[model samples]
Target: MTSDKAHNLWHQTCAEQIAAPVLSGDVTVDLVVIGGGYTGCSAALHAAQLGASVCLLEADEIGHGGSGRNVGLANAGLWLPPAEIRKHLGDGPGDRLVNLLSDAPRLVFDLIARHGIACEAVQNGTLHCAHSPSGLKDLQVRHTQLKTSGAPVMLLDADEAAARTGSAAFHGALFDPRAGTIQPLGYVRGLARAAMQAQALVHQHSPVLRLSHGAGMWQVETSAGSVRAKSLIQATNAYHRNLSSTAPEYVPVHYFQCATDPLPEELRATILPEGEGCWDTGLIMTSFRMDQMGRLIIGAMGDLDHLASSIHRAWVRRKLIELYPELQDVPLRQGWHGRIAMTSDHIPKITAIGPNAYAAHGYSGRGIGPGTVFGKGMAEALLSGNDISLPMPAIEAHHERMTGARQMFFETGATLTHLIKARF
Candidate 1:
């Protein structure tokens, strides 16, 4: 059972649980990883599998941050369309990233099958639903671009989309056979379990107090213990704390989700019958999916702790009725929120903090596939002394300006949008 402090549905429903004692003494290893989210756990697992002695430290429980609180869509690519990605990063690098992430869902599912992770793994597919006519046009372009890049994607018109989603609200949808969903917290915890089986030391409630490097070794100090290693990986993302100098810089946007009680079998038979995850094309995006027990999960961009949280909640209630009038009386069973490390260009980044230490962040809300792939790539690069396996070259530093302003802009915009847009 999950601790009472774990207020999210994922924690309560997660089938995988790992018990890691807090650090109490000094330890030495080839690599020391900070943070217990997907990237950190994946890095630890891959590094250990490569025969590197590894130590992973987490400030809280595994998947305590965004990894635990996300919408559970193990999507295939970034939020930006292919052309926009190419525009931000030129053709060569853009195409490379696109191709790498195009097959990311396969990598994720294969790992689940190989490790026997029981995280409600489903490989059916995902839908990019169109919220408006303009949104349909956008999906049309995305379908063309994805197909041009060899993705087996199908564009569905209004009738087809309505039939698949069990709602007449969407004008269309783009179906990608490569994408899927999972119980995210369970998946991350499963990775940690696998890493432990490979002889990696994992410590929970071990926050790094200070870090220093000299003579080709990193000295990481925590409250109760310390770690010395030749390399380090910081995978904290938006939940980073206590390490300001080396922490990633990005606009911290919040995303909140609400889940309903399991619907009757008849209702479940009609809604998302094929078990595909879904999200719509809107500036303030919304996501929808069903858990293994038939609970309908819906999410949007906004902070649930803000004063405007009531407005967001009200909007969700009304939005549910708008999408499915039959669900008008269904009360939300759980609601929670997490932060996203968003970049101006909506791309992930790997920054070289020091000689052999790297900090990766800025997934812009596309965490699962990219995080796992980047973590494995980082482990390979660090252990082999070659970075050719990395999807993108690591940079010296990455900076984001007006991050506070941008974060507020997103929250305020989401609040205003939710306040007025979903009314009957």
Candidate 2:
């Protein structure tokens, strides 16, 4: 089946009710934010709370994009480990960003608590499972790096890993006590609601058609009207619109997920009993987590709804059987897929298009915490009229290939690789 079914399940359960009108007439604000996902809502909330007149525009309903459709893992730091970050950005710049993100989970959970947003917030922890013996070595190094940086992390041996995950497929796991999970779509919607409550104007179904800067102000033109502001922030990330000249070049990657019906009471106690989110060590990563309702949501690399539907279905079934023989007969209740914007270096970017205009994207599938942190930083920078808040200093923007033919090529490549692995 297509992801439409899974999409509906997520939307119905996660999205909170909110009545946001579309932009009707030309308006002026201290700042205008494009994209109404977590980052955009976060920017609007922070800016509005800081006494900046803010207006946010969304192409669709709040949480309709990746923010709402995500796997709901609220993890600190980026996909890159701390040592690799230091290697890529050097000690000073890398350490600053790492330090900022290390505390991001705290900020996220705290914000949820402070705002009283009901998104099934949980901070139990997260586990990075090692799929192979060699993967355990990598996890060991990462554990060491995290410890050196003073992060609250633990290394689980094979026995402990199996016990915690309820599967012997993983050799070990790197447990980060700071990480957690939630209902992703609900969280994004909550952010929008919070921003609205704080007096920020959030418009749904208002995609920016054009953006121009002149006369010492940034003007964002929407379908219904125009917004003039002293500063503009692009928080679209993966769901970015073509309203600006500087299109960022990124590899368009897709990830798919499947969720089983809620487990029986007897089984729920042994499966992810502590309620930790988990992802494996494979290059083509896989994630698994249980919802508050006891449904098992399993995500993998290939795009099932987008391409290779049968293969993806087969893989999920095979994977579940391999991990837990008891779950081999469990039927899948939901299946969905979402696109990811990935840079060649696997790091997100904050690019500057003009004076007082900044755009950030490329989350590389790590969105929740980084998105919120980046949004908060971007809002601070725009409010204070400074660009120093960005983790990596903003750079110029460029366009990328998202053509149908290219997407087909990628799908074919992934299919072939998976088929080859199955054959071997």
Candidate 3:
């Protein structure tokens, strides 16, 4: 679904374009990985390095899914509050997952550095802006929790927040120095290239039509060929295409982003000068950041390509004016949207689909870091025949209730909000 205006911002600024051969003949390997997004690429890279003969397949080009079209925040932890996570998974496992994800930024940055990935990686930090008084209060609570958990997060005062954001719109903010941003598509593609260097075979346009297991091996069938392996990893995330295997069930959430052309030099100096990505605390999150080329990218939760697109776009224009009056009438270079696989409980799931096979999904909009960590963990787990080093315990069954209805509800809610807000 390549619209001229969809997901083109990243492509225009991409430092590298990577692709692999389409499946031409049947091949046998120690591991078969489905999907070529962040998780699949990372898993294939790690597994191959760990002495496994790995072959990865993608339905489209590498990172053509959510992995390529994300907000590029590289945020740590799930969208759920820390206490809520503890409430869901209990104390020990909850703390363990949090602790593991806390290091997501480092893992991602390290990979970029080690592999010399050309993605524009920024490590300064990120800002969770308080969109309202209540939003500030939410940040305060999050700040306390993060501090108690040994994180060096700072709660910036209103004045400081204004100074950093270059706008006086926010009440305050929680600054996490550990978090950062990246060129997502570039990063994912680089992972694929690195995997290839490590002796992993990656095939593009190889959609898995059937997946079946028998006689101690998993057979994954595609159009032109098939892969038979001792183990399998389904890392498709939100872009799962069904075959004989069941994709991870989730409530789909749409997030749309609009990138403005590079700001003038004088305007750029006053806006996000220190280069920290930002997101608000509103239930319908609004995010803003400047890319390496000084283009301002703003985003929110909604379908920006279809039914509610006009309203969403109009609202965004209003939002830009409200956030920065100087930016009134500024042209939006391009707009795009991506799907997020959100779990009801806001936790990522590593479900065991069958013997020696796993499906990991439900990042709830936090994918880059967790995806990498999960990929590394899933690869090791496949080899060891257990999830010993994985952050979260693998469940045997993962089923979501009313996924279709919930997805519709989110879209409708976002549409109505955009429609109403645009008028207001």
Over the stretch 1-424, how does candidate 2's per-residue lDDT look in tens digits?
5656345457757646678999999889998998888789889999999999999999888887778777899998988899888888889888988998898899889889988787888899999999999999999999999999999899999999999999888899999989999898888888999999999999999988888899999888877789999988888877777764656667777777788888998788888999999998987677899998888888777676654677876777667777777887789867787778787667788888787877888888988898898898899997887767776667676455554565566667666655544231
Clashes (candidate 1) = 0
Worst 10 residues of 2 by lDDT: 415-424
Q: Give the whole-model CA lDDT for all candidates, comma-separated.
A: 0.91, 0.83, 0.88
* Candidate 3 accuracy as lDDT: 0.88
Which candidate ranks first by lDDT, i.e. highest? 1
**Which digits, one per residue and each the tens of the lDDT, describe model 1 over residues 94-189?**
898898989889988988998989899998899999999999999999999998989899999999999899999999999998999999999999
- Report the CA-based lDDT of candidate 1 relative to the real structure: 0.91
**Candidate 2: TM-score?**
0.95
Arrange candidates by lDDT, highest first: which order?
Answer: 1, 3, 2
Off by over 4 Å in 1: 1-6
TM-score of each: 0.98, 0.95, 0.97
List model 3 lDDT by residue over 1-424, tens digit each: 2234244688778787776999989999999999999899999999999999999999989988888888899887778778889899999999999988988899999999999999899998999999999999999999999888888899999999999999998999999898888888899999999999999999999999999999999999998999999999999889988663477889999888888989999999999988999999988888999999999999888886676688788888888878888998678878887899999888999988888888899999999999999999999999987778777899997889999999989888877777776343
By lDDT, the better pick of 1 and 3 is: 1
